[model samples]
Target: MTRLRMGMIGGGPGAFIGPVHRFAAELDREIELVAGVFSSDPGRSKAAAGAYRIDPARAYGSLAEMFTTERARADGIDFVAVVTPNHNHLPSARAALQAGLPVICDKPLTATLDEAHALAAVVRESGLPFAVTHTYSGYPLVREARARVAAGAVGTVRKVVVEYPQGWLAGEASGKQAEWRVDPARSGLGGCIGDIGVHAFQLAEFITGLEVTELLADLGAVVPGRALDDDCTVLLRFANGARGVLLASQIEVGELNGLRIRLYGDRGGLLWRQEQPNTLTLHTLDGRTEIVHAGGPQLGPDALSRTRTPTGHPEGYLEAFANLYRDFAAVLRGEQAPLLPGIGTGLRGMAFIATAVEASRAKAGWVKLSV
Candidate 1:
């Protein structure tokens, strides 16, 4: 099997998501990182690439130059991973795709709806697989939830309650992580909504197989000096007559990545939490509750395929993120059509962020998702 040679666009020194992406990409051994334009600063980029033991010639200062140089190499990169801030995703992705390489990007597809649309246009024109790492969608049990919902185990989805909260920014700012995330220019239109709320939105829709038709958003800034929202709550209306609520925050004191989703339907309901990803709670109308464990025989093939451990062991955030990369590598190798969440799911997330922001700005009015 030919290993996928990968290049990175960001994830220089002190960049958070970039290292996580590297870890995930390396886990399966099916992909190899050959080169990168890892930082905006040329010196920083050189230092970062050196730290990873990449060839200095392969570590260019800009994405365009990286694409050109890498393409000229006989062993060029098969794909590029875009790990920059919201504003840089579009330009870097376009540069790689135009050079005929597939792309895997981080979420909130672009900084604005217009940029996201333009990206979609390019993706359609390219015909190359573009994946967006909505990491939660990579969970094994989440895939099970999606399968069960699609199979009508939950007959006619009625309501979805997905909430994600953390206390990292409860009262005061912390590090560079908290700084860029709360800034309007770097984090995009909505803060908490764009940062984490969109994950909740994507989870609810992905699991229950229902599309949100409209949403009413209520966002807030719990910290004193922050410019953008650190907390948010949204009321959602699904196309299939299902009603829902989504809450996300970075300011819920003492709370970790406490993301939970509950979907209720005519036949039953299903519940899953991020902190305890191995077990999925299923509720039936007949008053029976069953716990679905990852890698068990009861799981569907899709869910089973994502699991790397036995039934009792645990697989959390990093594993989930790796699952996305593993599956994407499979698709890139012509093995499948992306059973895992990819560009389409990322586009949905961007739409969710745009809608929530518009709704919150419109005095908490309803916003339609046009993406």
Candidate 2:
């Protein structure tokens, strides 16, 4: 099969996730970054293209020019990856979809629920493959956890606890990444929630296969006078009457990307942590504990397929992210990847953020989760 060509939006010289996306997309060699508009500055975009070693002519100064030029080429980019800030997701993705291209966007869909809805309309109308990088769901162990839950290996899920904590924003932050995240215009409301809390929200439901029916949220900035909530704690009611608690905070003094989930079922419990991505722990009602390593034979078929190496070789963020790109390549080739989280996941995530913000703002006791 020919490698699918890719065009990127964002990921300029100082960007973080843009390079990460590039690396992950090319890791499997199933997709390649053939063209892109790396920055708003035409000079910088060309410089980035030179740095990436892609053809200089394909380094477009604007999205419109990139799409128009690429579409006219016989070997155009097979899809566009939106790695920009939340504010730019809608425009980049909407333009690509309307131009009859598939899209793989960064999470939270858009800065606001309304923007998410509008972009979603474009995606549906285009009838193209749309994927959102909810990266954790691509992990091999995480996939195993979902399979275990679905197969009733842990029985009926009764409760879930998901938490993501980071200390990068503990003090005054003015870095490129922190700037847009702290600004409501760029990152949207519910700072912590929209940023990493959405990962926790999506992970819990992804593994348990239960929708969040209602929620009570307590969200605010722990720092002196920030505009958005940098700390959040939300109580959740699942569709099966299960209870959940989600904690997402950027003010934790020493924590660093500590995303973890624990789900308790009637018969047992499942535990997985982002810090330790290679192993999954399961405990039974009779107190028998089991450990499933990433490449072990005990893993389900989906999990096994996502693993790239033998049992001892550890796979972390980049590999998991690449798994998403790999499956996305498959989807682009007309294969079904049930585990791939798409635009609907993005919509529910936007709904989650909006509901959480409204509940926190109104101090509402319990609000129905509407998507």
Candidate 3:
């Protein structure tokens, strides 16, 4: 089969997730970055086309132009990747879907719940394969954990604890990533909550197969004079009488992407951590603990399918991200990618962000989550 072509929005020079999307989408040789309006500025967009090794003529100054010109070409992009900030997600993705192309968008769907609703409507109306990059769910072992939980490896999940801590923004925040994230207008109603908090929330539900029905939130801007939240702790109530706690913070002292989740049920528990992406620990009520490696034996079909190397090899963030892209490519080919996150994930993420931020703002005792 011919390789799929990708058009990117945002993630221009010095952008973090932009290059990440580029790297991951091409890692499996299933997709190629052929065109993009890398930056809103015409000059920067042209420069990025050269950096991406595509013809400068394909680099348009606006989303409209990119979609219009590309569709008129026989070699147009097969899909679009929206790697911009929270606000740009709706317009970029909407344009792609309206033009009869699929989309792979960054997390937090949109800057507001209303935008997510609008985008979700457009997605449903377009009838295309729309994916959202919730990165952790792409890990092989995390998929293993999900499979185990689903197959009754853990009986009746009762409690879940997920935490993501980063010290990068603990001090006075700077840099392109820091500046936009802390800005309310660009980052939406939250900073840390809309950013990594949604990741924790999404993973908790993704693995346990339960929905967060209600939450009590405590969000704060720990750094002095910061506008948006940098620290958040949310108490959760699940649909199946399960209780959960989601803690996402960018103001921790020495933590670096310290994302970990533990789920305990009547019979046993499952634990996975991002720092050690290859290992998943299974604990029993009798204190028996088993270590499950990424490429180890006895893994479920879903986990094994997502694995790249043999046992003892490492597959980190980029590989996890690539798993999504690879599976998405198959999806674009009309295959079922059960583990791939989609528009529903984006809708729930926006709900989670809006609900958590509003609850914290009002100090509401326990607000029901509508996701």
Better of 1 and 3 by TM-score: 3
Name model 1 segments beyond 4 Å from true. Answer: none
Q: Sort the candidates on TM-score, descending order.
A: 2, 3, 1
Assess each prediction's global lDDT (C-alpha) against the native.
0.88, 0.94, 0.92
Per-residue lDDT for 1-371 in model 3, tens only?
79999999998877899889999999999899999999989889988887778899988899999999999999999999999989888988998899899999999899999999999999999999999999999999999999899988889999999999999999987899889999888888889999999999999989998899999999999889999999999999999989999999998999999999999999999889999999999998899999999898789888899899999989999999999999899999999998899989889989999999999999988999995
Pairs of colliding residues, candidate 3:
none
If scored against the real structure, what TM-score would every candidate get? 0.97, 0.99, 0.98
Descending-lDDT candidate ranking? 2, 3, 1
Residue pairs in clash, model 1: none
For model 3, give the 10-residue run with minimal summed lDDT. Answer: 45-54
For model 2, what is the error of residue 98's alpha carbon versus the real structure, in angstroms, after optimal superposition?
Answer: 0.9
Those runs of model 2 whose alpha carbons end farther than 4 Å from true positions after fitting are: none
Candidate 2 per-residue C-alpha lDDT over 266-326 given as tens digits, one digit per residue, 9 for 90 to 100: 9999899999999999999999999999999888899999999999999999999999999
